[model samples]
Target: MNEQKPIKVILVLGLFSFLSALSGSSTSLAIPKIALSLEISSGLATWVLQSGLITTTIFLVAFGHMGDLLSKNFIFFSGGIAFTIGSAITGIAPTFSLIIIGRIIQAFGSSMIMANSMGIVSDYFPDKKRAQALSYISMFISAGSISGPAAGGFIMSVSSWRWIYLINVPLMIAVLIFGHHALPIPKVSIKQLKSATQGANWMGQGLFTAGIIIFFLSGAIFQSRSNWLIGLITLVVGGALTIYSFYQDDVANLPWISPKILHNRPYLVSIMALLLVMLVNSVSNILLPFYFQSYGLMTPFQSGLLIMLQSLVMLVLSPFAGYLADRVNRQLMTIIGLVILTVSQIGYLLYPAGMNLTRIIIPIVINGIGMAFFLSPNNALTMGLVDKSLTGIAGSLNSFSRTIGMTIGISFGSSILFALLPNVDQITPALGETFLSAFRGVFYVAIAISSLASIMVFVRYLRAKKTA
Candidate 1:
């Protein structure tokens, strides 16, 4: 067996992983510009962002199963190629529809990479080192999360929105080259590979993806129509598909998320906690930018800068949080993080509409730090709850939970804002007030969810102690 240094491999893999995540957040800062340039409605333009997320959400599980069946290196490299191609297409696209298409392709590539990145790390590192390695991965994600928006804004200010997509090509090429040289090859007998490939739950995957797509599409369509019959039909169809998907998973021997992991108390709790975190995180992200631009009377550039503070705080704190999870009680760390998040949400709710940037900056930073504290440690705890052999499945399920949460949060938050606004056609002072009120409501909901997650983690900790 080769004793190739794991850290070096992780560092290389981590850089590519960071870029993969970076592509997701970078487009957020360019939304207004893209909307204006494309002459698309803001709601429609949102699909440019949501398209990637929806694609990623659908494919995460399927890719995870593929990772387990195929070589991780093959999957990773293929994803890199797809991402690069998609970026090139997006960077030069003259039409908005083409851009959405590229985004979907990019999302597909991202799912492939994300589904297996942690699994690869787990395969390479021992348990003692795994948390630290995962910590590094989280740090990269934090860096991407913070930098992507800022970079997108800066590029858009100086050039065009297309540059945001253009920037990925060189980065991806470098990753592809380095990955080819550095990634270790997996050795398996042909019979083993065949069995693994054939064993995948293809029917479950199809049903799950079909259910998610139908549900989202139906909701999007139903939003514009006032016809109750049409709305009811869409709703019923979507509901049926979702129910059927889950029924197949539970009843059949093959399931999208392994029944074994889903049934575990710790694993289920971790999924719930992660879901809440993502919901809060995505809602806050959407609300903060809109709040600053509309209510705080800040320009898009200024709002982007202010948003960067949260990402910056995350970048600084995530590694420490990861290390702490290894040395201290992870459950305690999660609860503490949730507490800080709750405080941050309360701060946002209570902030005066006319407050200066300085007054609110502290709370924003605090919120970011809270996220940093939770994300890495929570991820570690979740994966740690399962056996090493199940890392791919666990990682995919975790990503899926976060994606679903983000989708629901963004959709629900936007719906509330639009419903509350008296005049949806124009941005006015009263509209701003309505939006803020909706944001306040959303934040309150976030606090409740975070609290529930904290309680779940606490209960899991007590159970673990009792068992021990």
Candidate 2:
């Protein structure tokens, strides 16, 4: 019965993880349809997506702290209810404003779930089994990410775009019912909760949340148009807010991210590397479709199929990587993964004009294997560095880094791409050669960023050796 309990927990939590991923990914597919249906500009419609990403990223750490102070069960159940209600509202939204509101609600709920899910897993599994269980969570994330676009596309073809959201209603209901029964109650007490609240720096938390939202919101808008007014104003203000938040932590009784955790050499370096690597990898993924369809003369379908291979390789290797992380030197494995990823980017860079597709496949495969190795092990090591009590915040901090990295990566890459092009808004055949040149430049940036990550990992290695 005890054995069965653990398995049930994984299944239920894994379902929650899947639904969350699907919700995020599928929304991209719905954006164009939404613009057409609502008679709105694509630029305005994009706010529907940005609202969700902004809220989710900003609230993760706060909600993770809530999990620690109160109970993981409290956050997860509330998230489920909020997520379900948000999805229904989104499905039935008559106007774009309502859709944005629903997405914000949904994103807040997702933050709660995201902030607590890994913490629960870490708490449930022993050290020996923790990485393996985390690997399954990673796999569920991959499955949902891979399936979302295709599933959404199919539904939109035969039905209204609203069905993309409506379909999640039943799925969330299932997760809620099963998760309520399967997830164990944490042993948090009201006394403990009160103490935690008293100790927490509420002012710092508020500042941090506001800063993150302002920063990301400005960046998202800046990506489409170089609107310096809103961009510079928000950027300066957000930066000030963030700095103040960190300063407040120095005086506060309890900081959102502990100074001890921030000061830890391996964990700090690992996080920097995670952000850089994710940035590079995301830029590569976002640009590759353009490379294939625009330059290589491949169809959209062919481009998607080719890119899907990366996920397939990740799916195959993630479990093995998790197993190896448990047995091997995690830092060593992570460094190796970074090296492999850098090599793959070089492969992309070196592909001769009019080269055959076969050469690209090898690099893509290597890229996948590298990601599989790095993500699971690095995550394990980051969480391991922190004490068990702060696991929830640690987990959310790790997740937030990835999300922020991806967001910034796309914006960075697009800005550079547009800057190099003859026209910022549209691409024409006259600019094919120009676009290819810009494309190559994007890979150069990726390679440089990835190489930087490798250097950081190697520095950690040297530091570890010195300490030893």
Candidate 3:
């Protein structure tokens, strides 16, 4: 590949990656407005957010396999078109139903992108430069996420929520045209493509998709105390379907959910580690805005700004982290980063109700540094340890794990916080201590979960090092 080709390739990938993050983050700020505009229940508005995540995640494995066996670039391009079209539909839709249809289409396209982007990068960059290149994805995603809310708010102030969805059309069109020339088109035999298509375990995929949706739906249901019984039943049924899906897959040829992935210890550990950290991080993200506004006496903008601090640090540090990931022992780097993250979590756990602004900033800074260090190297480990053919699947699974983590975190964090308060509508001055109790409970659970993840990595590899 020519030097310019690598640069062009990153530009194409980065644009789409940024677009995906922007859609997610920007839409969050617009959800209330959408609900108000449509005169819909908050419940229905939430579906707008959720449909995308569920669709994107469930489709990842299937699309990932396709990217590996058929063509990553093709799948990636098709996804872009789908996303753009979905954007147009949502932008113009008169009814909420149409908006949801648009979201589902967008999710379909997003799954395609998530499944293949890492595989494309792995193909384009040499091993020495791969992690650094991957870090650029992290940076673009962070930029999109941080800018999304601010941008969305600005658009809504002057224009309307529809503009947020509409804006991507021109940008995505530009990326599609650029990517046509930039993304490498790999050559695969017709025989390989045929096998990939014919050998796909359709039954297994359907069951898996059903199970994932039901399970996630159950979690969403649990947000309501009145629906706990239904949620429990749904959760049980979903778990059974997911387990059975895997059980059936064990005997299937060329299974979408491969047994090979489960057997790879390093890859398995890296995935687990990634999931755990995301779960931990997401809890803070979901719970903190409430804390900042309610207990910290901060305005909405101030709350957002405080949270943005972590993303800012991550944006700056990710590239450097990626650079070091290429040169260092990645496992060791992840472990150290986890250690720093543990320290930050501890800081949060111990901090009093007052949450002295200066002291809290220290932990937030540490969390950012820790995440930057852990994420890039760990991302490298996941795709790097797998074979070239499995790279796409590995990347999809990685994205899958992160999405699952975030989803569960939101569910669990909200459930735990509200469960303690029972009927409390607002965090009043009279109930400060009770709110603090629920708040600290989340961090306690988070720290415990993260420690288990750390030990999983540290002990498994410690044993390996000794044996070697």
lDDT of 1 by residue, 389-431 (tens): 7778788878888888887677655555555654464454565
Give the residue spans of candidate 2 off by over 4 A: 186-200, 227-240
**Candidate 3 positional error at 56, Å:** 0.7
Query: The CA-based lDDT of model 2 is what?
Result: 0.81
Error of 1 at 250 (Å): 3.4
Candidate 3's TM-score? 0.95
lDDT per model vs. reference = 0.77, 0.81, 0.87
Q: What is the TM-score of each candidate against the true structure?
A: 0.89, 0.93, 0.95
Task: Report how far residue 357 has shifted in candidate 2, in Å.
Answer: 1.7
lDDT by residue (tens digit), candidate 3, 56-142: 978988898898778889888889999999998988999999999999998899999988899888988877888899999999999
Residue-level lDDT tens digits of model 2 in 1-468: 487988887887788888888888789878899999999999788788888888888888878878876887778778887888888999999998899889989888888888888788878887677777888888888888888888988998899999888998999998888887887555666787678778578888888888877877667656656675777788778768866886787577777776776667777787778888888878878777767776676876688778878877888898999999888888898999999999888887766556477887888888898899998888888778788888887778777788778877876677667657744576544466677788788889889889999888888888888989
Error of 3 at 302 (Å): 0.9
Error of model 2, residue 88, in angstroms? 1.1
Best by TM-score: 3
Model 3 residue runs over 4 Å out of place are 185-195
TM-score of 1: 0.89
Please report how far candidate 3 places residue 142 from its true position, in Å. 0.6
lDDT of 1 at 323: 80
**Residue range with the least summed lDDT across 10 consecutive positions in model 2:** 422-431
